[model samples]
Target: MPLFKRRDGGSIRDRFEFRDVLGTGAFSKVFLAECKAEPGHLVAVKCIDKKALKGKEESLENEIKVLRKLRHQNIVQLYDTYDEKGYVYLVMELVTGGELFDRIVAKGSYTEKDASHLIRQVLHAVSFMHDNGVVHRDLKPENLLYFNHEEDSKIMISDFGLSKTEDSGVMATACGTPGYVAPEVLQQKPYGKAVDIWSIGVIAYILLCGYPPFYDENDANLFAQIIKGEYEFDAPYWNEISDSAKDFISHLMCCDPDQRFTCEQALAHPWISGNTAYTKDIHGSVASHLKKSLAKRNWKKAYNAAAAIRQLQLLRISSSRAVTGNSSSNGTPPNRPFPV
Candidate 1:
């Protein structure tokens, strides 16, 4: 159940007429619903099965808390939540414009300037989150959704399942998608909001080149590359990308969180704030690479980077217990790394 219950004694079904299913997951289903008071107005309602969420109740509650606190143009809005006997319902903004990469790939004339504008919007939203003490632990292409199906649709960051509030204290949990996750996160070190900046850097790199910065068939190798902050602007693809654009990414993707660009710094970069980002059409190259990379789609399926992180976390726990000679009471890793 959510920390706070706004709806006193009514069901979500009382206000919205549930329609077709938009999508489904292991323990939840998203349905398109129409507001009863306002005809034709639609919203997506996520119905989560309480029984299936046996061990993940806190995760659901955290997502609700974070989403409730966030109010930004680029971030998905949470309208209302309901707790039922068998399920929990979340009413959210209906974003029909699909994924960010899908829109980019479908565009005919994508450019560095266009990518810069997109990143600027994202930075603005993230800056607001940071200011509000919220950190979107996961920021990947899949989590970014278009507000509408218009040609000039704005991007909205969705899915706060892994998000955390500053009040949660120093976050050391190795979370977030593998390719976009920061080095500190992979190293199991205490981290802060700068991790989100690293993810934006990875997204910016992919936006310019249509592929991830660090990738390998082997999960360990990929984590090692990210841990070392090893990536390059390859020839041909990046030959035409502006120097300012590369500089922007380098600052955000820096190995050291302290050295990495903050959201404000990134927003003020020439690439985003100035006109240094080139207008040259990079769609052909970027789209071609995007199709070829299959990118994190494959990685998300075939490899479990989170599992590797969990293994590392487990190793650390074992080492600490050995040094302190305090056996774990439950015989299980504590605070198991949040699902990535």
Candidate 2:
């Protein structure tokens, strides 16, 4: 019996009105929903299967515990949690704009200036999470959400399913997105918050070039490429980017986790530090310029623009299907590293 079902064996829909399925993952499903008591207040409801969390009771508790203590502009806000018949549900804020990956796929690539603006926001958010003693572990594009449709949109790091609080100086969980995982993590070595910075480097690389730095068809080969630091930038994609931007990524992608820059230090790098125009007023502040701009636009227009971009990308993908089929084509996949 699911925790969310009624004693009479009714479904969750019998109570709350589930609007649309936002997404589905291995462990749970996310829905845009509204409660019977509050029809106008929209919310994102994540439903985790009781069976999926069966033996991981401690993990679930820890997730809630860490989320409760987090209060950062970049981190998603958890509004409430409820356990019904057999399902566990988490109510969260629903950002109007979609995943950052969607926007990045639409534009193919971003200018160094724009990339820097986005990375700064990510760095501030990660810094705040580190200060609060939480390590996100998973910081991929899929987990990043934009508040609205804007050039400098507010980015919120969501999906804390792999996050954990560390007190012993380092954590040894072999968790995180494959290409973005730090070398230490791939090697099963103990690591700290610096792992997040390493992932950020991968993200920055993708933002500038429109593809992940280390990629291979085979998982083992992919991990090897990442560990060996095998990467290159095509002239077409990187010709206009600054040397400072490249240097910053190189420093963060260092194989030795100990040598990688901390979130604070990374923020001070020339690429991020020099771009003061994009930095928020305080640490961890989302880019207000983009957020405000998005707020002023008609949402319907913004939606149409976003939809058009997606269609364009799909058409390109369809036309180049044969070329993309080659394992080494190195073509940037649509929004795989979604940039907002």
Candidate 3:
């Protein structure tokens, strides 16, 4: 039973049956859809107007090509694409939960443990992208999505409209979410993948404090604050978080791009060390770590709690399938309602 229903019998290229709208942005609109050939399978169809792709068609094509070649658990998966009559549509995985921004807004702020877990997953996804020669110029909460419900969601980095594939070279595009953009990017300097690390640091700050480290009513003042690297933490929030977590963030947020920690190094930090109860492996691997961390305070406790909830949810979804389903024993379906 899909949550959204198809619209007006409209179909993309006579293949994907358009369900309800998922979301809309400046250049495109996303819809939850089903492939006519594959009835129960669900996907996200991004419909970009031909007018919007006029000057940037090549960039959009490049993003599709790059995403097609990339396959990782942490990164959003692209299934298919087509350009019909006048519209360009990209079919991708339907991460059911929602945007990461919603969760941060709801919680006001996250604990240090939660922040570390989320950052680790983002790092892993970015690291995989960099390894494939793709640089995600846009790294922000809005671009990151949860695959399931908020408490036990898998974070998947999405929206590659501004992404580019760089073969060991620097990119000059001054593009990224405003508050999360790095100083070098703001200065229009040729930058490398390190810019992603800077954005990660900003995300880390927001996750722990409910707002960015540098914010101002005026855009100029905001840029100045970021350029100067001026930031601080209030007592209670700062105290509950571990010193190692703070050190790790400071390292990632280094003003000098050359000095900032890489994704690999960040994963090795002590703040993220320990076994995750929700995952099979110890320390939970970067992606699973973020999901499990958000579900519980301690890794072990959270893992166990998530597992229990998943079992219950599965039983509710289908008792017969709950006994035979091959989906991960750890995750719960996001579309299913859960008690707060």
Candidate 4:
């Protein structure tokens, strides 16, 4: 009963006036809502259809549990949750600035320094999550959002659907976007918080170069590349990026999780903490690659890909088959179109 109650002791439906639809998923729809008690006070209300979440309830519940415990400036805040007869409602902080990469592509003068600053904030939030025993299994650019449209708007990490707690114990589940997943994950090896750090490394790589480090038309080949930790900074792209920046990525993207840089270590690296990050404008190259590589990928395509991956996982689980780096050779792109 308390979950549905607002500060004014009214039910959630009566407390907030729901507005335009913000997002839609297989089983849920997020709406922009304004608190009636404080006019103009806004929030994102995710309305989930229980009937549609028959087999997927656990994922939603897990996300709620993880979000409820996380309190950080860079992480999206989950304000409250409620369950009604046919639907469950999640009231959350409304971030209006849009996706992280969109902001970067739109900027007139993006540089390594700017990329470093953005990654620093992400590292801070992820470091907090690690300290709290939470692993955001999914840390792609799509998951990174901006708090507002201001030039100095802070980055906010959103979408905890794939997040897991350390308490869950030995995490061997093959999850996360194909391009950003860690080597250990692709190999189906037991992984920990290092996966998130690896993802950050991949994100850092893309930030400097505008395209993914590991890419292949085949999912099996892509997995193989990641499993081997084979990726290059490349010319034209890396020609302008400083060595310190590349070093920072190498540390985080190490194949050995034990050797991979922790969030703290990454945060302290010269690229992130010092002045080694180049101030030169690489916006032309970066933006060009971003548009050429990621422009065609819309939210719907990403959502569908994620759904297909989930279904594939379910089938794999049912068959009691282990998915090794080489197992998925069907040539089918699991989370293709790359970085969702």
* Candidate achieving the largest TM-score: 1
List model 1 lDDT by residue over 204-234, tens digit each. Answer: 9999988777765445555666777767777
Q: Give candidate 3's TM-score.
A: 0.73
Model 4 global lDDT (CA atoms, 0 to 1) = 0.82
- How high is each candidate's TM-score? 0.89, 0.73, 0.73, 0.88
Q: Candidate 2's error at 319, in angstroms?
A: 40
lDDT of 3 by residue, 7-95 (tens): 54454647777889988977899998888888998899888888877887777877887889789888889877766656778889889
Candidate 4 on 1-340: residue-level lDDT in tens? 2234445555678989999999898788999999998999999999999899788877888899999999999999998988777888999999999998888889999999999999999999999999999999989998999999999999999999999999988898878887888877766678999999999998998998887877765454555567777677666568988999989999999989999999888988989989999899999988887876665575223432244346545555311232344433322334422332
Kindly list the per-residue Cα lDDT of model 2 for residues 1-340, writing each as its tens digit.
2222245654446556888999897789999998777778788888988888789877777787778878888788887677765788887888877777566544433455767878899999899889989998888776778987876679888878778888635687577766678867755567888888888998887666555676543454455556566666655546656678788999888878778899888999978988533222221112222233234334222222123324435555321232223443333332232222
Considering only N, C-alpha and C atoms within 3 Å, which residue pairs clash in candidate 3? 6-19, 277-303, 278-303
Q: RMSD to native for every prediction? A: 7.7, 11.1, 17.3, 4.6
Query: Which 10 residues in a row give candidate 1 its minimum summed lDDT?
Result: 330-339
Q: Please identify model 3 stretches exceeding 4 Å from their true place.
A: 1-13, 104-110, 274-340
2 versus 3: better lDDT goes to: 2
Candidate rank order under lDDT: 1, 4, 2, 3
